[model samples]
Target: MKNDRAPFPRREPSQVTGQRARPQEVLGLFATVITVVVLAVMILAPVARAATSSFVFVGRGNGHGVGMSQWGAWYAAREESKTFAEILAFYYPGTTLQAVKDPDTVLKVRISSTPWKSNTTSFSQVDLKPTVASGTLRKYASNSDSDFTTQTISAGVLVRVQNSGGKVRVTVDDTSVGTFARVDLVPGGSGASEGRNNVQLKTTGGTTVDYREYWGTMRVQPGDDSGELWVYNFVALEKYVRSIAEVDYDWATIGGAAYAPEAVKAQAVASRTYAVAKDGATLADNWADQCYRGYSFEAKYPGIAQAAAATAGQILTYQGEPVTAFFSGHSGGYTTVSAWSGDTALPYLVAKPDPWSLGAPPASMHSQGPGWNWTYTISADNLSKKVNGSLKDTSGRTVNVGRISSVDIVSRDTSDATSHAKTLRLTGAEGTATVSVLSFRSLIGTSNLPSTLILSVNGDVGTGGTDDPGSGGDPGTGGDPGGSGGGPLLPGEFYDVGAGHLYHDQISRVVVAELMGGYEDGLFKPEGTVTRAQFAKIAVSLHNLMNAGDKILVVNVTTKPFDDVAIDSKTTGDTSDWIAAAKKAGLISGTSSSSFSPFVEIQRDQMATMIC
Candidate 1:
């Protein structure tokens, strides 16, 4: 009997010939391994293994971890009597079972109408095999159906639609089912050969599914003509779930069952609404009822939404209510999301590690077909927001750029128009700076259009260029490389509100490099039209960049009597403080003109003045 404590006793190898000790050592090692295994078993006997508390029985197969499990669907069809609709519901759970709602979505089917349309056979007398015996349609077909052959068709098994005049049209269930392609229909058919016979199927959606074909022969037709009438008898090789925009809640499945306060539900609803609305949409429909697309938006797009969300608190506002939401998903499976604050960044963080970690496995709709692989991804929904923040060179100095006061994001998929909304507040002692607006739509091919990054005063949309802050030269010469006519910092150096330095300052090279990268030479244009929101973001960024490991200071923009201005609100950092400082320093004029157009492009002259 092996000793429970002795897993492997050290043993010296035989040194007889200097060669490794042969079979005996090998046997000894093998025995030692076995002894260790047995010892482990013996030692483990005293401590009972923990029993599995529960079995989740996640849906079969893999992929997006939502919708129907392709393999499960197939298995159910083969081993059980469930239909496609039933499979989808079983996997998706709380979803409302409904026909695919998109009109543009199409399902291809194949059918055999050849023998039935020969005219010699009556619809009632003709016996037909299941149509659409192969390809993509096979997934939706009956498990036992087989394709038609010449021997089977020539058997004259049932009602035969004989082509007496070589022309015949077979109508099934009041719809023409088939048509002979040639004018001379099989030697002797009835009408013209090129007309069509059709069959109409009543679907759950109250719409008639029509199957029609022309120029196809019946019976043991030669070379490619056999089984041609079954063009509509497709076996749904693949069922594509159409893309629909929606607001998906991650923890909603827990419901009240989990230990939480009643306010949690309210918060969940509010968050969901806020998220959807940020992209300019609303969530009237239940996301659970829709296909559990999982957290595709957050998982696919990382850093993008969180960055935007963190700034959203100070940027977007509507009717005194701060609104922010995220977006995700493309036509197929590509998805991303926008976050209005850092607090909402968790969803993306957790989902990114494993894309298909949620919901039940998908079911394959048919048997004997390859399983369909579903993919899910999450990313920052409003990338434009981050792009905007990065575009502005937020040196310590104040520019006329409009700072974001609050944020509101909307999901583009939902048409509710007003659900997604979130709020963020900037504090004075925060670690970072900059604000962004998360836009769901993509600017695929419109680079020439002016960018609506943070709204700058002088109309500069993105980063500075040759035109920004104007020419760096003497007033009369108009060609100096340095932007700072006589400011403390160099042309390419950044400046904080109160921080002072000489023309040839000894600032950190990183800040100088950033400024240089932002502009040519070093001319700080003082008369720039930086938007109110952009000024806030740039100020914070510049301060942080210069201090490196040091935190920046900011003051809040005071509440304005203007209907659109809400001063008390804060963002991720001391947004209020910075806004207030800028406002106090005459850097930004509050929204006195009813609305602050933050998206307006900046101008060279305006940039120069703002820098000044």
Candidate 2:
């Protein structure tokens, strides 16, 4: 939102005479009028020109160009007769497909919660009743002031849970029920972790809805800060996967027609693998994780359910452990490595050619999706505003490089037989600054720049120029048709040297190792000691890399190896799991027989020994 208008010139009123104006006076008046008109044109011309000046972004694809492309998978299945396994192999080159033996069949999903931000007086109510499938429902109530208390309710009983003024009140069949900070509903005789129970609820609008048949227990809690109500559902993994497939993929249409069964099946496996790899930390109803709308979504798309059932318990694995199955709407013409997508390079996630996205036969017969190729025209002033707003460097530090004057694509990757920009140089009034392609996309807005597989950036410099307008040219040339100059850094390369050691190549190598494994950011703090928790994560990553392609046994232990690294410890976050895994791998030992000094930092020599 830059103001590109030129300043308007001041105007003087014309002088009039009482009698007929003299010929010289008339001439002078005409000259003055002409001068005024010329001034107006001069003032408005640049504004008009800038208003019309637009940066034409000719690009292809959608979402981050990483892992599997959903559109590509669909095309492959339909045109090349590729099976689900074949499609997965084509995308995740070095990964294997394996079944999870005795995997946790149940998942706890937070379906509905009070809005993160709400007015002080705002409130919400939820009506609940047990379904026929669920027998003898019991409620466990708890609050900040009391322990959990249990009560039994009939299957057909109507229960209303309301939140107001940070207090939760419950009522059954119009009778006042006890108020509590939290409530959990489970099968009468079943433990919290046992049984698949279903519930029916009525919306505030009086619409009846049947939620998913959840396993384990359902928790209803008052929001801690927002004073809102939260409803959590514990559903079976297969059921959750089925619901997510429908939400993530267009079941009714892909390429303007019903999606092929195989395509849907591929989606099912990918979604299932993604959920299974979460290590029980993802919320079932979270869009950041997976979109799960409970039984309503599952019932609406019977086809999705069928697809999930067809691939039940199946997941994409690397070496025997679940692989991080990332998927996107499109790959623009080629798929890229994880590093290009702001992640560390993974052996299974290498860049590769995507013929499906190039529009393979059979699937190509239908109308193309919007993300197949797209163009956007944005004003230069607007572009500068966007760049000045939130551009950042490799170390996640914000960069204020003033108004952008030009943008040059410096470095690109052609390994996948497709060209994509990896580094971009932004020339502004303040100075020229270099940023990753991902950072540029983020600063300009993802919806505007879609993918890094850009064809050309026309009007990147100044107001007007005879730049090649959307030529879909080769990116490796490193030429900005818009008449700009700069060189790009090595693709996927981050960090030049360590902060403390001026010439220590070994420390830089360790930093590189950590970066490659997605452990450290671009900065290499060589003089900085490694914390116990940090070392645990590094050691675990190394262990995984050394045993790549082997089935890793994911241990489910209730007890912590060190009392300080307990599950609920605020300091550990999720690193406790890594600490336990490192101990199991014999990569680290506690300072004492039973205590792991998790907060203590290890010296450089000790870190070298541990790494060795």
Candidate 3:
């Protein structure tokens, strides 16, 4: 047992069962929960945003919108009762799960490389501290890991390899150790890959790209005899597989109930299979390959090791060869084709509906992060900048447009209930520009767009961007103020706040100016009560509008004025920033010295005082 950190109950290699008879068709696999899944999906909130004139996009899923969606697997296992093989078969169809012949095969995993010196094209040196929990450290002059001699040293020995005088110079504890063609830092006299204890690699102000403590043997060999070295953590395939932190294993603690274990077993097989397929120095230690955080992650999440152990020697094979199964965080609502990324489309990697990713048992909606069905509103000006920036580097595409006033979907490629944007047309002052949805996402950033699968501009958008912030079209220019019930209705006013209503003009002007807007569901809810926090945000916006040259922006929002108003990372911006601005403007004096009745309904006099 590893004594480094608290771990889950250890399971034997054969305990975690692999491969059951796969259902014939995809529909049959999820048929048991089909009705519930569909019904739950149908009630999902339609894409809505505040009545702001920005280009609001409403969509589903996240990640690259392809392969096995982690969110979908979570719902299928947690709520739908699907097993690991069943989930794997659903995402990667036409594939079979099989046990591998050699799970203990050695794997050279790239942990990270030393930073390339600036203003030069090559790396100079690497500084790493070698240690072990039980075994001593050794500087192997030859590739033979077990051939330990006088070079064997205790733990906490700092080793630095420098490229000087046409040879790899080795310095230990600030003294010349020796120079050799290949420098191997082994953990005791153990075999390079299958070791009893791991050689921990710690950064002593040397590496920056992926700076973290690592597991297994640390090997430093010249990349190509150019005095350049490539570093790797040489661990047995099983140890490397067990440390892949791909999904949220700690999620089981939610509601004091454990999440399904089979989902992680499925991931273990996928990660193991993906790793088994790679060779040479092409693989990496990031999401591009798979997030392999080595020992520390394995210690923190014992479930990862448990899953890998359970699925040891298990891999997904297509035909006879093992498959490189691709998985991602979320898939909006559908798994897409590899062709969507300009890669060779595989027969089994076709598009499929991933309803579980949308949400199931609506009560638990967004118990996961905001990836399910999310909304992002970008102003016309910002969209134009992203479009031009993307086109600036493209060889064939050129941008003549200034500020984009329109964003329209030209085509969509969907698998089922959810759709992904394929082509988008942007219109601006000078002219128009067309961009593939993939290119657009690459330009604007995935953090904002998340996934093209759910790209719906301006409310499941359709075509064209909104002329105003709100997608309800114009909020009407003309209305009889304080009218009991008179005058012709103008173009586009809130269903409740119309020409017949009193103070219609006042509401229209405010909505147009974006001083206020309706809920995300597009409802005015005029009769709804307002809290001090809500009114504070509005007052600050009004102040900014009046003082455009000196726009009021409150920095240091971490310093809170009211105890009730949250200022943490979850609520870092927007309302929090404006709330601080409101307090500074004397618009809101908390109910007492420290407490602000942020959620309590504001009285008419309090509203009147805020307006004053």
Candidate 4:
């Protein structure tokens, strides 16, 4: 009989006298117990194992990756012996290289304006005088409300203008000439019409010189706000473009070698094209439009001026119109669509492979541009801090989110022959959110994670120690699997929530309330000052988003509420509609009874009160 229970009971020992069991029965019991123990171990081992908790981010590129890559152009020109036209053609495919009809056309750039700084009730005086080396100077004023009249003035004559109690006072040669809201200065021979004018004045050395020799016209006007003066320079387009190129591009020797002249020419054309595409009503003298340092910049960088002259009148045109030429410091290994860079899609502004970025000699050779290939390491704690901020939507609405845990690249676009992450998945302790790759880059710090072209993400979730290094390969040829011909990803549809800001909480709250939105470049710019026009747009958007009332009609309005709010007014544009609507709703009042002071800068407290 089988004795199951001896020392270790396997079976009930046949209900016999257990003390008298044979050694064989005890052995049988031991064997059966060992078998059961082995089976138990096999079933429980897998359940006790550990899980993976880390990830890393491997990426490439440095900018929005749209249009031309400065480094790539340099490489093509230096290594491949390509011309500027060839480089432009490669980057802006299907676009025509054309020449401007009037290269000497003037650009109205607001260089120094105090209006955006104050809206107080104080007053100030601004003195403007035109001087020429050999030509006579003249003052042009609006004869009728719709026509201009001219009056000859002596060269080097002082014209004093003052803004007091929301009215303008004008005086010439210390005598009261007239008081007008606006005035223009022209050469003696030039007509009163708004056009290019010249002046000549004697210098300290007693030498007469042309006004263009010193730069161009200097127009002074009443400040949009109190105690301020708005000064502008009506500069020739070529000169303006040259000034920008000198400041933005590095003309210094690199690795004991000079930058390719073709690259400089390419930049000149691109910059000129961008300027031409703008409406030219009021271009900023800085990067808001493009860096313009006046005659000082042109005098400093003679090489930049030469490049501009070489590409004089040349611009990239699409279907008979100037195309919006976009460029950046480096493309990493690929270029992206204009839409990826907060711009609308165009036939010419498409992404393409950039082999020059990879084929060029290493950074040690001094051929590679800055940010060509980069790396960044971020810890989990820091990442959490970055994600718990607010991002504004396209509709000017803000969305505040919580701490971030994991980041995943979901969808990609390869329509431009290069792979770039279009959509990003951000997981937080509270919930998960999805955003455009561009928006994510902005929130994460554009310098930290420069571009949307990613390779991998590796690390422990929510616990830091992630490495984001640029990938290595031939930038021109490598293709990411399943990363081409994808549908366009709209950036305005997503929000950029992150940390490292002073007004993070307030901005996040306002964005969530749908009262304000981020710039197209994907920055909330919490510390940036807002103009009256900008505030008007925000107010109107807020009222509409919150469905405040039907009192304000933002639709087609034949009449303007303020003199400065008219369609043809200096500060007029899309904001005019919003200003009109807000005025009709009694949500906003003018600086004076008739003057809206649309260009004045609004303080933070003022914005808050207006919103409330």
Candidate 5:
């Protein structure tokens, strides 16, 4: 059955075995969509299944299918005797390798972060731009000059930092050291057993408080609202590269055992370059960024340190600047971009063939097995739970599309030879949804699906209740895209939008609510971008919609906070009062103190922040 996707979980066919519904009836929110939609495929943010016992998904590769494929590189190095520079040249085409101008750059690698107890969404923090959410951000600790307190710490003292009474407190030897905004722990005394890089860091999560060593200063910083702290390892660039243990160093020993140091060296360069690229941004010390194990990982395989030193300062540069070198565990056969990062701006990060990942690995390749290919079978009931549990709508709420019926591979990425599956359509009793393979993988564990590079699917699902249920379905809620039942009818001159139009119902809702209106020509340009002034009026209307008696008055005022606004504030379409009122309500802002830029089209982020 054909499914026109509406933000991930699309509504079931609008007709159910015993009822009819709308897209909002299924997913409960309005959002722009991702992924391709075909007769067999679609995309989503939510799901569930009921008709079948289980569907077995067999897939290949691991990690996001973008940038370098580790197995591909390893095979090239081990079999083709490709040099590190040559390997890098092939994987990161159109990039020049340059020596480091500064080898000691410090990277703020977040080694540990506290969990959000109430957050059950499937998407990880890495999916968002700003990784750390700041809570009541306060001024510096009264006794310290900076938000992070470290210089005054006693030499070799064991420190435990935790949130206390909304203030972060540091304790040493079971005695309260002080309450501050942040704490820096220096593992000294016997704790510094593995030299500078091998100092162990004990965490509170484990029952016995297990520790991991790092090669730099460990800073514990408090988060916004939670009692949790984000621990970072402020390590130097070279040392940080040496500390990465993404893959074992033993891959250097091939069948011939002829100095094949290229693979590990290439990894060092890639890892270093990625860190340098993300120098200012928050980075997790895991695969979410790069697997940085610090001193402990370094100690386990000393060869990695040698490899890092050998490729010291070497980085992949595109147009003279270091590129955000992304690398994955394996590519089924080719690498493609994940939608989270736009591909247009990053020309180097595109889909390309990688014939190497398909071949057998060398005996010395370690855990990278041909056995990496995997199959996982999950029951329909569990599939529903897992999908419904994590697939969050754009509003960041979970909408259950009761018990899934059928799943179809709708589209594939035609950019490269791998032609990885791009979208999946899921049908359920409550509704139907189509979601990107990337997002769907999150609904089901990545460990289960591995990558979107599906070799084949070997299972079946019952037919969804697409057949019309007895009687017309229940009316949709506020989220209904169809503006039916109780709502003011649009003027007859509004000929553009009719019952069959895509946004006919949605347009009806806003028009009926009186938040917006048709143009002079009786046309509602639903697809057009909204201007700042236009949005201002909408914002004011929104405030008034919620506050019936107390509406924001739009009056004529020559003197206002902004000088660029027209003198006659209340003239029809003048926008001055709307701007003033929205700004007064703290729902909008101008380009600057004097300029409203009222004619400028509003950006997406601006709308998000104002709505938030």
Candidate 6:
């Protein structure tokens, strides 16, 4: 109270009426400021860097970064605002987009249907021999005997119906079991068909044996029962197959003789030649018939020798029986062409020769980075009527090559990002060419696969014993494991509302493209836990389906009953978009607390809730 009016009474080293600052206080304030600055740098630096990395730098853009950047032309076009045709010409350079003058002249082939039959015997074929029980039988004394009794012994044969088709199907007995294409006989067990029976036939003379009839169908070959013949251009197919076989055989002989007895190599070549040269039915005589039927090498003309060689390589077994050398006329394009060819069974004509690699193919333009240039040449040897080619640049300019094949391009830019879009376009050439490009972006390419071959056995092993051929043929659409052709789809294939983040249309389109119009379920149930990892896998599979090599996203949002979810957590970057997209689509929802509970055992009801 005395000091209330006198600040100087207790103030020590104070300016006016204020108290002096402590040294630690001054240091603490300075430290706090420094810590915030450091933290900001730590957090913001990465984010800033990532943002800078996503951009695609611009450059001249006819699909040929070197030859004609169409976008550059388009830039020129926009400056002049050219016609679509003009735009095409600006990038294409020498090519012309002509109308199909005689489309019908070309032959088209498609697999109408694939039918399968079981080659294995059925349950009815087992030989069940009759055998009397060996146990002692007690016969009672008759007539005067007061007590009489008879002891009868019983024995059973074992039989089991093994559906060895390697596929799950509801059997005739209405039980689901894995069906194998080839079912072997196990014998002596209770099965769908009873092959054993204990019974005595009474005849006027004495006791007689009883016969039992067991019934079942034999296993058939795939694509046979339905009589769904896979049609192809008879002449063209024969030519292709023969050629592949011939090439394969010749290569094997030449390549192997260097390591084996000369006789063995010569024999292989002779056998292969004879097989292609034969004229009738058996391998010994079928060459002429094959040629007449458009399947032999000689019948295919300039294609004959090549076809025979190729066919021999494919069907003729080497000493080691390996696939022959896969040559690519095109250098940079071999890996791409081979991969696609292997799948479709398409033939590959190498598109690149050595030394001329001027740059990267137009397809690789978009992926190029700063300070690089590329040039490429494609060939016509690999082109087929159904195929079309394109040279695409990162700038969104695609030089449509139609069916013609030779091309070349060059490109350059100051900045690496800006350098990528330069390229060249070539058409009408084939056999091999070179492409060179300077770039930081990885190049990507694709090719088509060759067709498959199906061999069939003669039909009609007599009638009556066979199952009835219904309105649909044997092994009809109904029997297909992939699902019946031209019928409604399955539930699992359907789009469940609210349960998935994907739109029905988007999923349907993908399904149509992939599984080809068999996906069924239509409704979606939001506000439920999505379970059944199989279902999750399928849901997330769309990312790969759409973009091929890109990353995917996956997430879970359900109630809190499950202890797996952590608050404010996220999946890694690669799949984040898919997971987030799913969330945004109303396909997923959190548990009871409204927060996505990522780790919880999904219940059946929850599955239904999510997939509804």
Candidate with best lDDT: 3
Give the best candidate by TM-score: 3
Q: Give the alpha carbon lDDT tens digit for every residue of 366-409 in model 1.
A: 11111111111111222233333333222332212233222222
lDDT of 6 at 504: 29
| lDDT tens digits by residue: candidate 2, 1-612 | 000100001111122233443555444433443232233233322332332354555556666767777766666666556677777776666567778765566777765431111112122566666544343333444454346666666665666777756667878779977777666666543444333445454334444444445444666666665546666776668867767632233433445443566777877888888777777874635434555655555667677888889888898888888877777667765666533334455656645446465442122232223225545556677877876647786566666677666666665555221345676777778887777887777667776777777654552221111211121211122111121111121222222121111222233333333312211322222212346777677556544544545523335446787878766444443667777777776778776668887866554444544442
| CA shift of 426, model 1, Å | 24
In terms of lDDT, the poorest run of 10 residues in model 4 is 1-10
Which parts of model 6 have CA positions greater than 4 angstroms off? Answer: 1-297, 300-302, 306-564, 569-597, 600-605
lDDT of each: 0.25, 0.54, 0.57, 0.53, 0.54, 0.24
Pairwise lDDT winner, candidates 2 and 4: 2
244-276 per-residue lDDT for model 4 (tens digits): 632234432333354577877888898888888
Whole-model lDDT, candidate 3?
0.57
Candidate 5 TM-score versus the reference: 0.54
- Cα error, residue 538 of model 1, in Å, equals 6.1
- Candidate 3 stretches with Cα past 4 Å from truth are 1-53, 113-150, 154-158, 162-167, 188-215, 221-229, 251-258, 279-281, 338-341, 360-371, 392-395, 415-417, 463-612
**Candidate 5: global Cα-lDDT?**
0.54
Error of 4 at 230 (Å): 2.7
The TM-score of candidate 6 is: 0.16
Question: For each predicted model, how many residue pairs clash, with residues at least 3 apart or on different chains?
Answer: 177, 5, 9, 26, 22, 143
Q: Pairing residues by index, what is the TM-score of model 3?
A: 0.60
Alpha-carbon deviation at 157 in model 6, angstroms = 55
* Reference-based lDDT, residue 558, model 1: 51
Q: Per-candidate TM vs. native?
A: 0.19, 0.58, 0.60, 0.53, 0.54, 0.16
Angstrom error at residue 391, model 4? 2.8
